[model samples]
Target: MSSYKKLIYFTLLLILLVYSVQILNIARFPSQIDIIKGDSRNLNIFFPFSLEIMEESSDIVKINSTNAERLSVGLKNSYNLESTNNGIAKLKLKFLGIFSIRDIQVNVVNQAYVIPGGETIGVKLNTKGVLVVATSEIQSIDGKIYNPARNAGIKVGDSITMINGIKIKDADHVIQLLNNIKNNKVKIEIERNNASFTTEVLPVKSKQDNSYRLGIWVRDKTAGIGTLTFYEPNTKKFGALGHAITDVDTGTLMKAENGEIMRAKVSSIEQGKKGSPGELRGMFFETDDVLGKIENNTTFGIYGTIYDENKLFKQKQLLPVGFQSEVKLGKAYILANIEGDKVTEYEVEILKLEKQNVPQSKSMVIKITDERLKEKTGGIVQGMSGSPIIQNGKIVGAVTHVFVNDPTKGYGIYIEWMLKEAGIYVNNNSEFAEGK
Candidate 1:
């Protein structure tokens, strides 16, 4: 062989070596990862790792969990690990991989405050001694005589002035005395609108527990909608929306600063089932401000200011606070702004009317059946929270939540509860007179 031939062979060998180096570099690059929970029970790491270039002699790195070491021969990337809990290990990697671990401390349960209901067992207080009434007829005890406190005679919107000659305080105190009452005959005094009356009644044994029981349910706290939870009926001032508005899963009142109520157009509505319910869905724009001002909030609904002066809905006249008790579970309707600059009407059904004793913050389980409503909202969605629930031509509740997976099912709040919180219907005024 000549010298020229030898030179050509050496050059070919050099080219092959370069090609192999390029292939190696490509294989060594790591993928970019922003964050990872590490294997260490107490550690977490945020990685800004990314693959820069692939070269034959790039970097060689491997993540080892057992040794807790990032064996790096030449790999390049930065990583820092931190721990938010004890006994938890986290392995953060730049060129390697990440691992996460949990310690006992990581499993600690967080104690957060929930609305109204707790295990303590008893009615919770909203306002001091103030019992906003939902029914106009007074809750009467059965004296078995032609007593004014009789179910029909008592009237739905009547308020008790005293029980057994003792001035009634709050519903809780009434409950305590009623439970301990050993007297068969007791005197009851009540007020209706402004008139006052007195009666006597003999207690009867409750069928469920065989304990002496009052025939009526007296509520200390209420969360529902009514003409006025409190009326300066003199000031003509009214309050509506009883319970506090809160985020479903977070159980935290949505910060007014971070949230807004927009006008939503209901696209659809679905009926509720025994356990599964339905909701209203609509298109919402940020420009729409809420119809009222946020006043008081609880688990029930957000009480706020109302600006609508027309008062009567498109189809139904406004029923006063006292009339709510007669609201049965049946055909109903809702007042929603499903249109532009107009509040359209939609049909719903009250499948169940929960009594005051039960937690029906999502009151009056209902289902939307209108075709036009169904197409708009897909069922109940956000921004329709305060929409007034109307049943039997009366306001009963409002929409609260939509079932995540089930667009048709949603929760509702009782209108009575909202009104009660506002102090509109003072103690025992559950009945609503058709006119003034």
Candidate 2:
């Protein structure tokens, strides 16, 4: 073939490859989208292609430029969808001249209600058993060092729940069990990475202490203070600590068999500075003011149900939860308790908003703008992790982490995700709904 003819053939092949990519991109959209009733959303198709909504499951949803006689979409490549009622609708999308058909599930749901939390509370967590924090060498009776835990495949972050079919309690309890067993091999039941297994471990007689040793260090409980994010009145569920409570030594998510939320008194404040994060030094009030029980410690936060509703902050009205899509880059406020038991609202500016389709902790970047807060805590401090952020009279998110280099700026988690982690369902149908 001639050189000119060969170049023309190559050009055609490249065009075909581009079109193929567009086709795949259009087909890869999520099959299901959710929206709240009376809300609209914009659905955009990135590539240059035509789309048509062939059928809808119910009359609760309406697509742009759609009529009863025929459903046709123009070559705009983007369309608006509105939910008129609360129901499920199945939309058939015909892409690229009917070359591919994709089904999109549209669900309309009700709006959510939750009480915004800003009180400083104490958190006490007890693991199912003792967590192995480290392994060490034990001097045995024969004047030799033996690492029984390492030899038995027990590593850091593993929870030793049972030994010889008996439940292990605290560190001292494990010591007593080992002393009683002496040098005999015992079955050690452990949980690692959410999986359970058993291994036979032999205890070494320590020459220094004249007792049996496992050559491991374990912890059974952890306590700290954090701000509350919200409380659902309908379910009596509450979420706090916008981030997970991980083990300080091992830096792993702590598995809580049981925990408590109690009132806290701020003793002192260590102001935050560049390259260092400050903290609120507080003491748990030793009273019968237990507010709730922590049942879950998740990546998003800690979730539980309140026992005494009267113990929580008395808000005249509950705040409407805001979805991530509705979060805007502008002025906002964070409710936090920096001083003794008094929750105060501080002004903050939402610097950046991230468009996230999945659940994530840091959804927005916020800066402390309130003069009083800056003077008090020097920006976002350690105990302000779960401070509720309000935007446009709606609870939008919570404070998660502070910027290491700039204490004045920090990351905020979308409140919708925290609510979901707390087992409170929000408007699920807003994911695919497009507004005009």
Candidate 3:
């Protein structure tokens, strides 16, 4: 090829690459805004922040607005932009002591605009804050039976604090460590209500691989929710979210996913602050969903056309695509009709909204606002995924996950996202999230 021609081709390639990268950036923009904005969405089910930091001081990398000015704060420190403030601002730090590793690893660090004193040009700094993590591996057996986990001083319902003195990074790390140390005795730590404890256990050898096994099961992650996806009036059969719930430890989706979807009523919710996220909690299983055929339970939603729809809905209307945009910021509601119960409503607020590149959970935030709701579910507790998020008299999204440290702050997946995964189309009348 001629030199000029080669140069032209290379230049074209460079342009294409730049364009591609720009497109990718655009795709991730909404999620980016979500993290910065925090909990403006009313649902306590979505975690918008990506990065988290564990530090003694609240000094943060301040995030500034494009239109405002900056304050005299130390550079390189984390900060947050006030939605109300036109410029960069830092939140007063609170909470001291050790933070969960999961809370520190979320993706919240990114280039933030810091307008210093009415200057349009702003400096970029990485922000620090708390992130939420979830797990299903908590062990809280009803009766105290002697077992390896217990002998190691591991108590039922005690949250695994750390493994081998190292923080439990994620479900994958926990599994990998357990699988590698087969038959080997290992130390573990746990935390409950701000208190920390430790224990040790020897893994048993598995005939299958001659590797060590801990007869005890542990979990670290999960990401799916379903709303009584279907209900059968007769025989009292009901399905949720049209998908199977999974156990992150085994990397297997529960069959018949026999776990019941309880009514998690929410109580009070903390407002989303600069570093710390909020949560909701309430009681559940005041009713239960009997196990039935496990048809389809994918990332889209849970599915098992139910045997009973009578008790689930006040009146069953062929389900429609729940438009997320119609959801307002405050005084929203939820419809949890799982396990042969009437679709009950709970009060919540859309604290933040980011229709951008959301992670496993969409880029939105919410807080449970109803006291009656809190007393029922421990503030967005488990078995509540797939509860329909309704606002402005429309179905918007389904509850997907909860924040362990702060149950009142949970995560939710946009209904359209779930519908797309389920091969359901968003009709013209349905509102599609902009730039998502």
Candidate 4:
């Protein structure tokens, strides 16, 4: 073969190999897929190979090829799957003549509903136990610098639940327990990374204060302000933050042994800038009238029960919850309280929608388009984390995080996951009947 022809052939072969690898990389579908009954979804087949449905578990799922002829070499294909009935289905895809099979589990559910929330609320989280935020060098009576907590295998982020077989109540209680010990080793039970273990540490008498010290800094509580996402009227359950509230010092999720949500008023707004996220300064004084009790502080958000339904519904009404498929890239509005206790709607543009089969915090990228909101808060800020994102008169998602470089742009979490975290199940069949 001529050298020119040989080079051309080699280049073509390399391109084909690259394409094949790409197809193989994504050959398998996600373990489970969910769709509402009577809804249709498109599945993309990246490989240049024909596909045949080898098996289907239910007749409710109807699969049809959209571009089967395009499955030729160096081409792609797609299929449309429709759900006619609500049930689970198992689909088996076979690569034509390739002997490769991929299985997909499909769940056809009814519709869901949730009450949209945008009220700015105060979050006061008391950890299950005192958390070790930091360790320091203690100057003992002998004039020697000693790190008792460090030497005892206690690290930052560890929760000190008990000391000397006594349950620790708070930071002051921990201090009292350590000071009462007289230069002796004491057993400490701590929870680290979900594992519970025990350790012994010797308390040293501080020369400066003439008190026994453990060379550790601990915290028992954290408080902040954030937007409320949604509330389930049937269960009186509420979700907020759209993300976990981690300890500011330890950077770990605060285990909410007991917490409360209180009414807050935005006192001031600090506009966000590049690399510097702004915040909403608010005062929550009416602590006596507890709005809700926080139960779980998971990655999805904080789940709680609202005590006063009248207070939450006085300003806002229940809105329909939108599924991931219903979310589109277009204009949307967020409910937020930038001033006082009144919840107001602000315009934003849905820049991108990520179709995820699994739950995730950043389900969509949104940008603040409302001139009023942009001028007031400089786009999404710290306290706006759980602002309910409304599209087409339905609550689709919640604002989760803002882009550090662009304050106007931020991430959102789908409302479905927040409802799941709140322990609210969506009955699509009944929701559709109620015109939700």
TM-scores, one per candidate: 0.36, 0.86, 0.38, 0.86
lDDT of 1 by residue, 1-436 (tens): 8999999998888766754563444344222111112221112222212222112212221222222344433233332222222221212223334322211111111111111100000011233222323322222233232222354344444556577777666676765666678546676776654467877765554445544544554443332222112222232333333345433332333322122222234454444334444433344444443333444545664444444422322232334331333557677776555333346567877676554422346655677776677677655544445556655544556666656666555566765555545544333321211012
Q: Which runs in model 3 stand beyond 4 Å of their true positions?
A: 1-23, 26-244, 248-292, 308-314, 317-320, 337-342, 356-360, 426-436
* lDDT score of residue 250 within candidate 4: 69
lDDT of 2 by residue, 1-436 (tens): 9999999999988877866766666656656666678888777653344445545544777777422223333223456778887767777666444555676777766777788889899999888889999999999989999999999999999999998999987888899999899999989999999999999999999999899989999999999999999998878999999999999999988888899999987889999999988999888954557899999999999999999787675644698878776789989999999888888999999999976655888899999999999998899999999999999999999999999889999999999788778867544434323321
The residue-level lDDT of candidate 2 at 240 comes to 96
Residue-level error in angstroms, candidate 4, position 297: 1.8
Worst 10 residues of 1 by lDDT: 113-122
lDDT-wise, the better of 1 and 4 is 4
Rank by lDDT, descending? 2, 4, 3, 1
Question: Tens digits of per-residue lDDT for model 3 on 1-436?
Answer: 8999999999999867765664454334332222122312221111111222233212322333221222221112223332321212222221121222122111212212110000000011110110112321222233222346645655433456466766665545665777776657788776644466766876555544544444455444333323443333332333344234544443343322222333333333343333343333333332344333334445545543333333234445533333443455666776653223335677888787765333345545777777776665556654456666766644566666666666676676665555444333222211121211
